[model samples]
Target: MDVLGQLVAVPTVNPPGESYGEMVEVLHSIMEDAGYEVSAVEVPRDYLERYIPQHADHPRYVVIARVGSGRPVIHFNSHYDVVPPGEGWSRDPFRLSVEGDLVYGRGVVDMKGGMAAAILAAQAAAMAGAGDFGTVELSFTPDEETGGETGVKYMVEAGLVSPDYVVVPEASGSGNVWIGNKGNLWAEVEVRGRQAHGSTPWLGLNAFDGMARLAVALSEELNSMLSSRRSSYPFADPREAAPTVTLGGAVSGGAKVNVVPGRYSFTVDRRLIPEEGLEEAERELREALERASAPLRSAGYSVELRVTSRSPPSVIDPRGRLASALSDAVREVTGSPPRLTVCPGGLDTRYFQLAGVEALTYGPGDDSYAHAADERNSVSEMMTVARVYALLISSLLSCPGGPPRSTSS
Candidate 1:
């Protein structure tokens, strides 16, 4: 609880990421005090300048802690960054509030609680002399709330970690384990027209009208296309099994109520299922935009589209040795087997999986409350997840085990 309090107090929000140095220091101190060798690896300024130039002044860091040595290393990872706290909070978002078993704060459920749990679990396993069999590694990374360009992805690309198995303690539900997550494709579209007085609207073109047309076209074409395709992977909701598109997440247009807007722009969020291929998805979106814009162009409006980011879907066999070991630990600690499912959201596990390392996610808290106004986590659930992690570390690293077979979707 004390550890969780310290973590929650530092609001490491990730758009232009705040207090990253302080957060890394806190994690480093915790891991160092736990009798593990720790390293605070900072992302290079050049990389930052090239990729995220707006955040060049804000440094990024990943705290890595390692105990013991040898083959079949088990790595536990959690991102320390949290989303910005929006409106409607009853209490201070940065202050940790405890009521009975509930712990409330901005990042409590979205995953600083999971970070604390992983730390405690690693400490407990180390104290039990579980290091005799193999190595246990813990990484507290940054930029997951955005993309992990400088966090897990950077580490994997720079050869900072080479683990046989990885466990990402994301905010999966108490009785659930996430073996995979959906991919994301973010894009922005812009339209240009002439500005003129609203009283004589025919004197100038309306950019907003073009934007509306494109939105309608997307709703008619993209939505219908997505409806016909569904994933074979199991999800609690059938709707989650299909790809989804959300438009106008951020939109702006018009100079004033009395003026015709000269320019308009909006964002797009497309989530791809595990079975979907990235190239095909991109091609479909591009084709849709091209078809929709032809009419707008003929009507004297200029349209432009930009794909800001792309993350391909990643998955692993749910019945593999890593999943079995973690599930056994969950059952041992919670007295019931956890259901293995594909997360409908994006996760950092994709980075590890892309590196050819088997990975899965299991932790406390309901993911539905992740970015909610009153995000909270259960104290008892946190402890239960900690015990589960410690037991899994002991199970896999306390004895010799062969390398698990590689499997992917």
Candidate 2:
């Protein structure tokens, strides 16, 4: 817990990911000291400059440490990056502060805690000569909080994640093993209108009014249309169901209070179900925007919709070998079976799934604490997660043959 606390104290916030380099150095030192072969790979400078300008020079390093050899490589993946510590903290967000049983810090619960546990667990396994059957790899990445385009996505694209099975130490609390996650599409809607003095309101078209009408129409359409179909995951709550549409930001063209706005813009965040791929979801959203703009078009207002980000949903076989192995490991370590659930939000698992790997999200800490002020994780929960991960790798290697054919993408 002390070493883990030290890691949680180093705030590697994304966009800049300032502490990524430092964290990689620490991981390298630890892995090397533990008698494991280690290496680091920096994301290309040109790519970083183009996509992540804020962290253009900051290296998004991957520290890979291996133990044992041969087939059935079990990869433990976790990101070192964390969301920016927002307002409201009782103590310093960068420093891990323990009050009784809970350890509080910005990234403690969201993921640093899980990463620390994974590393320590691997070290423990190495000491116990537990890597006898096959190999164990640890990949600590950066930029996971911002959709992982520069982190695991880059690695997977480069063929750095060719593993028999992958386990991401995400904040899945303690009881749930995340089997899938929803996709996301972010878009911006712009409305153009004619501006005139407020006194002659009839002579001028109000962009604000046009946006308001569009918002209402789109909101109603999303609530009635998108929320009708619920997910079939057994762990999903019936009342807390379905994909959702959220209106994020809205901007009006008017600078003065007395003028009729000429231009308005708004952003939409659409969470898609597994049945709808990224392209299909975007097409549906485009149709909705077009339908919503019809009223404005009739009233002589121009509307345009542009997509910002599109990510696909992912689902791994819940009853497959990888899932069963992880479940048995969790039960052996914690004395209880794990429940499979769908993550309501997006994560790097989408990238692994796209890369054709049998991957799942499992780790400590509650999802509700993610990105929240004074984020924290239970020390005992992290210990349990470490044991579960170690046991899962061991069980997978000991099983006859390797991962079941069904898990092979």
Candidate 3:
């Protein structure tokens, strides 16, 4: 609780990446005091300029701590960055408030609480002489809330740490283990037309009308295409196992009611199942848009499509050693077999999964409160996660005559 309080008080919010250095320093101290070799890996300014230019001045850092050495390495990761506390809080979001077992703060539920648990788990395992069997690594990273381009992605690409198995404490919630996460392809469609008086509707090509036609065509075509496509993976919600599209998350159009809309654009939030690939999803979307806008093009309206961002879906074998070990630990600590599932949204696990290293997510707190106002987590839940982590580490490192550690890359 003390460690969690200290972490929560730092307020490592990410857009402008405030207090990242302070957060890294606190983590360095905690890891060092727990008797681990610690290092702070800063994101290079030039790299940031190429990837994320707006926040280049703020800087980014990932704190890595290691104990023991050699094969069967187990890596634990969690991000310190929290989303901006948007609205409605009973007290200060930066101050940790403990009332009985529930602790309240901004990052407590979303992730810092889980990071604290991971720290304690690693510390307890090391103190119990559990490091004799293998190596354990812990990393506290930045930029998860805004995508981990400079965090886990950078770590993996820079060869800062590599492990046979990875645990990202992302709070699958209610004692469930997340084996994967959905990917996304964000896009924007713009329909351009000439403006004229609303009274003479025939004189101008109405962008709104063209946009409406394209949106409806897209919904129909995409829905039909995705209808037969469902993920083979298990999700806590059955609907999440299938691909989905949310249209018009943001929309913009005309200035005056009397003017025919000259321009219109809407954002597309297309979610992919683990079975779907980014390239195929994008191609299908573009083809559909082109087919739908053919008539609009002939009618003097111009259509444009922009792919804002895209990420690949990630999954791990549920029956693999990493999943079995985590499931065993959950059952041993909580007396319930965790439901192996995939998250509805993306996570840093994708980075490791993309790197061909096995990774999974399990931690404390209900995921619903991740970005909610008065976000909080139960102390008992955090401790439970810590116990599970400790047991998992012990099992992976010290289990005798278990699965042989793989020597291949």
Candidate 4:
């Protein structure tokens, strides 16, 4: 709880990804005190983007704590960045506001609390000589809320961590381990038109209108497939829960009401189920977009698409060693086995999976409260996860440098 409070106090909002350096130090110092050799790596230059203006000046730091050099290195990762604390709030978004058992604050449920739990748990495991049992790597990353190209993605691509197993303390319900997540394709599409006085309507093309046509046409063509592609993952909105596309995250173009829009741009959030092939899905979308934009092209306009990010759907083998160890640890700590879940959204676990390393997420936060106004986490839940993490670490760090025994000591 103490660690969680300190974490929530730092406002690491992701829109522009600010104050990452501060967050990195807090996590670094705490783990260093617990006997881990920590490293702070700046977010790579190539990863920075002008779209996130803050990065042009504000530095992003990925803090990594290495406790041992043993084999079967197990990684516990969590992003420190939180979404904006929108709208009404009873207390300061950066400070922890408590009631009964709930700890209210921005980033509490979505993940900072989870990050704290991992840190404390790692501290306990280190005290138990768990590091020598096997390697334990705890990474605190930023830029997750905004696609992690500059955070986890950077670390993974740079060979910062090559763990045999990874446990990301993302918001995965009470203590359920998230074995996989539906993939995502985050893209921005633009429609171009010639600017002219709005009074002379026929003199110029309206990019906004052209974009509207494209959206409608794509929807008409893809909505059916989205609805019919039955997903194996369990979601509350099953009827409409298949692979899907959400268009127009935000729209921009016209500068004046009297001027024809010269250009229009919008974002797309496309979710992919495990069964859906990413290439096939992207190809289909491109085909649909090309077909829809044909009319606009003939009319002397243009369409351009920028794929900001793409993550393939992750479906880990649930019976793997890491999953088994976590399950055992959770059962020991909570008196029942934890359930395996498939998330509807993306997570840093996807990057580890991309490298063929088995990874899962099980943490303290309540998913329902994530990114919502007055986001909060239960102190009791955080404590429970900390205990479970300690147990899992000790078990996985057992005898062999590579695999745990049939049961932990």
Candidate 5:
């Protein structure tokens, strides 16, 4: 708990780069003392020199510690970075406070808790003389928040992680196993119109008015489209089953109230299903927006759409051996079957899945606390996760050929 509390106290915020250097050093020392060979992978120099030093280097600093060397290697991956603490808090956001069973601090639940649990589990196994069936490796990378193109993406691209099966201790709450995640596409639409005095609105094209029309059309079309295409993950509430389209932000061109806005811009957030590729989704949205903006264009306005971020949707078979192994681990340790759910948002899981590695996200902590001030994790839950991870690694090692076991029906 003290170790975890120390990790929580270290602010590893991503935007301006947190004190990852300090956190990494601490983690390294912990693993080394536990009898594991540790190495530090540096972030790219160019990325370090930039304003965003953490991202500037595109660093893939992985602290790798192995117990044995061979096939059937089980790799545990987690990011050391976290999102900035958002508003609302009753105590110091960076300080880890223990009130009863809960540990309150930023990143405690988001991930640091999980990382701590994994480390402890490995340490326990080592102490017990649990001979490695194959190598057991833990990779602690930086930059998970902000979707910065550094951390895991760089590792995979650089051939750093080629484990047969990967487990990312992402926040999946207590009674859940994340089999997959929804894809996301973010795009900005800009409308150009002629500005005119508010008194003579007829003489000028109102960009805001044009944007308003587009928004309404998009809302109607998206509601119908998303509703008609409902799909459910075992963990998601059936009532909320469906892809969604949301207007995230909007900006008007004209500054003064008396002036008719000449330009307008709005951002869209689209969640996709596994069947749809990002390119296909983007094309469909562009077509819909273009059609809606056509009327405004005919009235002497122009509309443009640009994609900001496109993440492909990913899913793994819930019945697969990998899923079953994790499910059973949760059941054996927690004494309750875990709900298999699809993450409503995207995460690094997609990156692993795309690389053809069987992977899943499972960890203890209330995900609802992520990014919020006063984020926290339950001590009981963290300890339980540690025990669960130990069992999971043991089970995997015991199985012949180290293949994943089948899930219970």
Candidate 6:
């Protein structure tokens, strides 16, 4: 509780990306005492300038610590960064409030709480002793709220830390272990038209009107395809059984109300299940854009397509040894096997999975409160997660001889 309180008190907000050094220092001191080698993987400022301009110059850090060495290495990845507290908060977003079994704060539920739990688990394991052949590592990132481009992405690409198995513990689902996450493709399309005075609208072609037509046609085509296709994966809720398409996060066009716009554009967010191919889906979207804008193309205007970012969907087989160990730990301590499910939205686990490092997402708290005000987590659940982590690490790291002794809390 004291460790969690200290973490919650620090306002490590991401948009502006500040105050990471303070938190890293605190983590190093505690981790070193637990008999782990602690270090920081700094994201170069120049790299951030070209990749994530929003975070340019702001120091980005990935805090890493490990105990033991070699063979079956188990890594725990979590982000300490929290989204900006929007509104309607009952109290200060940085202040850690403990009421009975709950701990309230902004990042507590989103991720910092998970980080604290991993630390507790690693500390316990060290005190108990981890034999040769098993190594435990904890990696805390600084930019999960911003898509982890400069945090986890940078760490993995920079060859900072690579383990045989990874557990994100990203506040996935309350009692379920998340083995997969939905994939996404973000893009923008621009339509060009001649600008002219509103009084003589006939003199100029209206780009906004042309773009609206394309949007309608594309929406119809995407929706029609989505209806016929459903994911093979099982979801607890049957309602969300198909892919999704969302257009015009914010449509911008036209100069003034009186002026006929010369150019119009809109952003699109398309999500695909693990069964779909990312490249194929993107090609379909692009081809559809071209086909729908054909009528406007003949009128002497043009259409431009730019892909913002895209990531393939990630999934893990529950039959794998890593998952089986985690499941066994859950059953040993909690007396019930944890369900394996897929996350409805994207998270950082995709980075590790993409790197070919086996990864799973499991953590405490209701995921619904992630970006919401008055976000909190149950202290009991956090401790439970810690126990599971310790047990899993011990079980996976113990010699290949006899079954390891129980580390159940």
Q: Specify the highest-TM-score model's number.
A: 1
Q: Candidate 2's residue-wise lDDT over 1-409, tens digit each?
A: 7777668767788767778778888888888877678889988988787777776877778778888776577888888888888899889998889888799998887788888888878888788776676778888888887778888888888887578888889988767888888888898888888998988989899999998899889888777777668777654565434777889565546668888889888899998777777887788888878887898999999999888888888888898888988998888888899889888888787788777788889999987888899888898999999989888877777789694433221
Q: What is the TM-score of each candidate against the true structure?
A: 0.95, 0.93, 0.94, 0.90, 0.91, 0.93
Please name the candidate that would achieve the greatest lDDT relative to the true structure: 3
RMSD of 3: 2.4
Clashing pairs in 5: 41-61, 43-59, 44-57, 47-56, 47-57, 48-56, 48-57
Residue 73, candidate 6: Cα error in Å is 1.1
lDDT, candidate 4, 1-409, per-residue tens: 6787888888898777767778878877788898999899987564675435556566788888987675768789999999888898878989888898889999888798888888888888788887556688888888888777777888898998878789988878555888888888878889999999989989999999999998888777778657667876655346534788999988888989899998999888788888888788888888878887898899999999888778899879888888888999999888998888788888888888888889998888778898888888888998898899888887777734455433211
Which runs in model 6 stand beyond 4 Å of their true positions?
131-133, 399-409
| Candidate 4 TM-score versus the reference | 0.90
Per-residue CA lDDT of model 3 for 121-187, tens digit only, reads: 9999889876667788999889998889989999999999978889998878747999988999999
Residue pairs clashing in model 2 are: none
lDDT of 1 by residue, 273-326 (tens): 998988898899888888878898898899888898999988899888898999
TM-score of 3: 0.94
Cα deviation of 40, candidate 6, in Å: 1.1
Report the candidate with higher lDDT, 1 versus 5: 1
Q: What are the lDDT figures for the candidates, one per model? A: 0.88, 0.82, 0.89, 0.83, 0.79, 0.84
Q: Cα lDDT of model 6 overall? A: 0.84
Clashes of 5: 7
| Candidate 3 residue pairs that clash | none
Q: Could you tally the backbone clashes for each prediction?
A: 0, 0, 0, 0, 7, 0
- RMSD each, Å: 3.1, 2.9, 2.4, 3.3, 4.1, 3.5
List clashing residue pairs in candidate 6: none
Name model 2 segments beyond 4 Å from true.
Answer: 53-57, 197-203, 239-241, 249-259, 403-409
